[model samples]
Target: MNKKGMAASLLTAVMLVSAGCGGSDTAGTGDKGGADSGSASGPKKVVFWHAMGGANTKVVDQLVADYNASQDKIKVEAVFQGSYDDLLSKLKASMGTKEGPSVVQMYEIGSRFMIDSKMVTPMQNFIDADKYDLTQLEPNITGYYTFNDKLFSMPFNTSNPVLYYNKDLFKAAGLDPEKPPATYEEFQKAAEAISKTGKATGGNFAIYGWFMEQFFANQGAEYINNGNGRKELATQSLVNSEAGVQTLTWWKNMVDSKAMNNLGRKTDDSKKAFSAGQVGMILDSTAALKGLVDSSKGKFEVGTGFLPKPANAKDGGVVVGGASLWIMNDRADDEQKATWDFIKFLTSPKEQAYWHINTGYFPITKKAYDEQSVKDNMKNFPQFQTAVDQLHQTKLNTATQGAVMGVFPEARQIVEGAIEEVLNNKKSPKDALDAAAKDISSKIEKYNKTVK
Candidate 1:
């Protein structure tokens, strides 16, 4: 849902979905870069290229305006490249070239790939080099953006998946809106009841269900393993695990039982069924809140809540999702200084609050959460609180830390396709998952061997 995971790099919907949350990405308060950080004797100017659109990107423009007005020491120029691929291609082409921006916005799944490239400087170095105060920030939020023992990027547009429900459907189905679904049994019952209404083809619980690995992930299962070769890598696919099978099975059964509809699904689906009120409930990226709200056009009431629990649920916490800001190097001294200053400014509590209010993404800084401005805005609109509440509910792990692999997007494709076969009655859930595990293992092994 959030444009930060494997989907962010591979799926177009998730990336543009972020654009709906806030203003378009644009130039910052500092000057555009022609030189590097500085000459070790003068101010620096830097250019930052990102893939933000609409209002979400515009926030960057205003911030840049303010930064430029505030100081003469550094100047930053922010540019909105096309999509994730566009930015990546631009970055790839800029490598070793003089015409390159000093900062870039990267989606999460793209992180490890970039880290492997070794063309950019880690933000930990940036923070240490400047002595920025990262301690005041929420460690968990930043953890989602970190890799290895060092940080290559600072957090921005962070969010987790959430269950968005249609209250009217719940009421029509004779279910309590306040009690959507908290347990596995209850969720099934709700779907069954909604299906009984014959609103459409059975009852459809909308989302990128096949692609969203939240259930097993939330339960703390391994999507990848410690492998340096094919055997270990193949053994670690984890799709055959009890939790993994259970997760995939539940969805297949839901579709077979006519409690959920499997319709028009592909590699990338907009889930127009849910937003158009053709379905009852959906678990989507919190970053899509604004778009969902805008798309609804006030026809039906939107209810937001945490994902439901499992049958013998031993855990109830969720995981983090979304993207981060990466620093691109090769700038002169003045540009580096400007990029550094602007980077620090972007994470400030004030700006964080603005980003949260203007966009539904979570603020990375603790101060942003407690700031009166943020609290007041959330007070006026409580649904925003639901996302924040889920923050404490999630305890991070590999499943939730997200599948950091070279071919995760492909692995996801394998799994998602396997599930679709089951739902489409082309195969049984058990058989589908087994086959998916095999296909995924093959790719995982290929990727694992390539990794250092």
Candidate 2:
């Protein structure tokens, strides 16, 4: 059969499976409890699927409860959908049916795929229809969701990578604990100094592609071709370029010098190493600050700093890393309207400040910083200010805006494998990166064809 025929068949199968599944009929039932009817007997129920768990789940639950209590017209039910990958898979399986949630929290890498799925109503649609003011939100945070002069989703649980260091270890190494490394060279020097003391490993960054992505952004380099996939659909990966090579080479040298521990790709393992005082420094997300601080309470003093950049790069910036909320298009008009109201409530200044305080994620709204609760929280945990300052310092260019591609999850896996190979001395940085790029190019080609 033709490609179009195959695509149609697949979509039909998906819709059939979705319709066969049974669940609570709370979502997409706009007529029973809609705000338009002005019925006080029951409120419209909106289902929200999210990937948050553990401590973060508590905060999300509180936000849902608060939103439900604040209004009589709408009630939201928060559902935990495992990890981001799991959530995406389930969402895909449930598309074109009433079983799907009215709204979903999708991770950054899935943004491209979500757009291509054509199952979501772009936030811009509601914004334009209502003439809603979005000037209060942070431009840098919103830039990640904006593509081709359109905003696709609402920025939520936004985060960026930051340097976390053991202040006590730095002091013991005869380095100034207050002054963290600001450049790549300075970081290397400090790493060497800490390594010489033999009390702790110099650094312990996770073998994850996110850090490499941040490094490329710091150098104003694109991760994928065609302007980080913003100008057009990217045909290939550019992660094997000069900037990428330099960044990988530096990481390799640090490992060789026993200055940085190769902690594999597990973020938890690397975080444990740092919190246990086995490593003097580490690179991790700002979302981890609260957990790290809490874990290292009696062990040592934890300090936060901006991710170091290469000396020659004048435009140093980091990509916003996290998830956003997307409203499903299959819902009723009232359900869609109710979903938008919940999204707005969640992103309001008061809620943003509360979220930032409970979780270490950055507040997407600019006015959230001016809130007294936010100001007091920042004062209590001054380390969070480092993340805030770094975000503000970031410029909204194609590089910093981050790559948008349909096969980003697969690409990240390939890159992570290359990093592991380089760290293990199985392949040189250039060789591994070249192989990974080639593999990613093939994947991207296959994905583009399937979508077309």
Candidate 3:
């Protein structure tokens, strides 16, 4: 055979060998690279992993299609992981290898976890390099992914817990649908009245409000030393603080008085109760907007409203609640570039505005709020606007950054168990929270050592 023919045969053998190895899976990441070392024509394929489900999932997939159609430079693929835990585990295991997708949607609390693994690219680097207007972003939401003044990730969806009421119940119970509870006292009274009436049961909500942290935030209390979660120093425990104790005590009282139920968090059963008119008021997540709206089955008009705070918490409002997005660093250079592009596209004003209107998540871009479509919807849909308005009311000091302890999930579970003890009369509020404080402090120390 000629020399050229021999080279062709040798190349085919190399291709077969590469395919059986794990190299072929790397391209499966959907990142693009061309024949030349300097290929920049755009990625031919990109893989995106997320845990979004149901009708909302469709919107995300459509958005991917829209991005793909906008240019021939990129082709995107979407894969749905069952839950956040599943996605986190999968991503971690695939790190340093090519089995992972180029882009993944991660939650706000997971931001640090992702960063600690050193598998994530600080998204702010990409933003700066591209000269994107970082200031064009809302300052409040940006804090979620910030660490030591550097932004490590892009926030995707932010969900805060709000008050959702049964409009007909509100009216029938002699309460004005327009005038919802503005303070914890008002909330208690109103919940009590609604419970006694046929509108709702007195104990609709339980020991813990939806989200669990609102009582502290609404009361203008600093949950910890730094809400931003910079805990390199020996962080003090705020749950033992005056505001923390006050909130937990009040919650205990609320449950004991039967104004709110001592039941568990929002579950499928809880949603059913609230939807079926068994519960008059619920402090639930904004993401549940789609769920509640759909489950109502047109039986009643679902009225959404801002969360009520304590009278003492008057003047300023609370910061946002819920999740955000982060990008993983364990991928090829081409994949990181592709993921960054997708992140920008997803957070663009048009997408933000649409997502805000459709889902319960808040938009991180001020421009999204400026859109005529968003404005029109706000006038038509007060729920979306209420959250935006509250976002500006957020406090910006270290106290406002929110929590970042590794055992946070474990800490939250401790809080849950303690709250349950209080409701069941198994322990006093002081004892319950005190026990949680001790447990959390210990866990925080252990996690700190690991990081240290």
Question: For candidate 2, what is the TM-score?
Answer: 0.91
What TM-score would every model get versus the actual structure?
0.83, 0.91, 0.83
lDDT leaderboard ranking: 2, 1, 3
Q: Report the error of model 3 at residue 103, Å.
A: 2.5
Candidate 3, superposed: residue stretches over 4 Å from native:
1-44, 206-210, 226-228, 231-236, 293-301, 314-316
Instruction: Please provide, for model 2 over 1-452, each residue's C-alpha lDDT reduced to its tens digit, 9 standing for 90 to 100.
Output: 55334433333322111110011112221211121322447788788888776677789999999999998889898877666765665676565445778888888887877776677889999988888888889999999999887889998888999999999999999999999998889999899899899999999888888888999999888999999999988999999999888989999999999998887887889999998999999998898888898898998999999999889975859999888999887788888999999999988999999999988789998888999998998887889999989999998899999998877877888888999999999999999999999998887887777566
lDDT values for all models: 0.65, 0.83, 0.64
Best by TM-score: 2
**lDDT per residue as tens, model 1, 45-125:** 667777666676777788788877788777677777766555655665555557667888876656656665555678888
| Model 3 score (lDDT) | 0.64
Output the lDDT of residue 450, model 3: 51
Q: 228-304 in candidate 3: lDDT tens per residue?
A: 36745335456666666666676667677766675574345556787887777776666666678667756877777
Per-candidate count of clashing residue pairs (backbone under 3 Å): 37, 0, 10
lDDT, candidate 3, at 187 = 75
Candidate 3 collision pairs: 30-45, 119-329, 120-329, 156-325, 203-261, 205-261, 206-261, 227-401, 227-402, 228-401
Off by over 4 Å in 1: 1-43, 199-211, 227-235, 265-271, 294-298, 332-334, 448-452
- Candidate 2 vs candidate 3: the TM-score winner is 2
Model 3 poorest 10 in a row by lDDT: 15-24
Best prediction by lDDT: 2
What's the C-alpha lDDT at position 53 in model 1?
67
